[model samples]
Target: MARNQQNELQALQDTLYFIGGKWRIPIINSICNGNKRFREIERSIPGITTRMLSKELKEMEMSKLVKRTVYADTPVLIEYEPTEHCRSFGKIIQEMIKWGESHRAIVLKKRT
Candidate 1:
């Protein structure tokens, strides 16, 4: 591969290393779409266990894509929200949604 191609591939790999998973995108979308609490996120993404959610959230926080806030209330309410850095992914996510819809339609038509 050419030098430019190698550099581009590395960048893509780095991006994937951060958010490449079945759970991470949904987790991000849930929080971005206003599902702030832990239970809300878990409910939003069906089939995700509490353990998995906790683990992924910790990873995202370390990557600076998500922020966890704890409020000193009667019971210490915790909320999750996407960081400003994560806002950069909004367009990328939308493009992925568009591509997925088209790909799904194409594959389903082949099946039927």
Candidate 2:
């Protein structure tokens, strides 16, 4: 159709690619909220397994949005922190949260 419609569709695709999968954005939001360790993230997310958390953390690390560090002492602990790149999109995430809340409210109002 129109050039603007094509651009809009492309942007939607890019956004989905940027925040794909069930665990990615939740992991990002959890890390952003100061859940810095693997166990802590698992604990905060509640239903995520240790294995899945580790896998997602590694993926985010590779994607450059999350930083993973391991300290070589005793049991060997690993910590996860969001990179500056992830923090740069704070406004976008905030807007998504706001939009979701507003949409839910309107939909609930219609239902009731």
Candidate 3:
């Protein structure tokens, strides 16, 4: 492949890897929508088990997509927030939502 094609391929691969999982994007959306606590995030995404949410959050933290914070008080509190890197992907997610809505309409129209 040409150098330009190789670069584009790598970029596409990276993006796919980032959003490859069933839970990653929804988890990111939950956090960006202000579901910071573990339980809150879990509840916000239906069909996500506690174990899956924990696993995804840990992976996202390792990938620098989220910042995990711990607070000490009467009870220890932990929260997850999207990092700037993750926030940058928000625009792409929004565009995807738009495209998905349009595609669904088209499919329904064709079916009718």
- How far is each candidate from the true structure, as Cα RMSD in Å? 1.7, 2.2, 1.4
Order of candidate numbers by TM-score, starting with the best: 3, 1, 2
Question: How do the residues 41-81 of candidate 3 rate in per-residue lDDT, one tens digit apiece?
Answer: 99999999999998999999999999999998668999899
Q: What is the lDDT of residue 73 in candidate 1?
A: 100
State the TM-score for model 3.
Answer: 0.92
- Cα lDDT tens digits, model 1, 2-87, are 99999999999998887778898888777777888999999999999999999999998998988889999999999888898776
Each model's C-alpha lDDT?
0.87, 0.84, 0.90
Q: How much is the lDDT of residue 44 in candidate 1? A: 94
Shift of residue 82 alpha carbon in model 1, Å: 0.5
Every model's TM-score:
0.88, 0.82, 0.92
**Higher-TM-score candidate among 2 and 3?**
3
Between the candidate structures 1 and 2, which one is better when assessed by TM-score? 1
lDDT tens per residue, model 2, 1-112: 6999999999999979988888778788888888887777888897888888888888878989898888997899888888988876655777889999999999999999
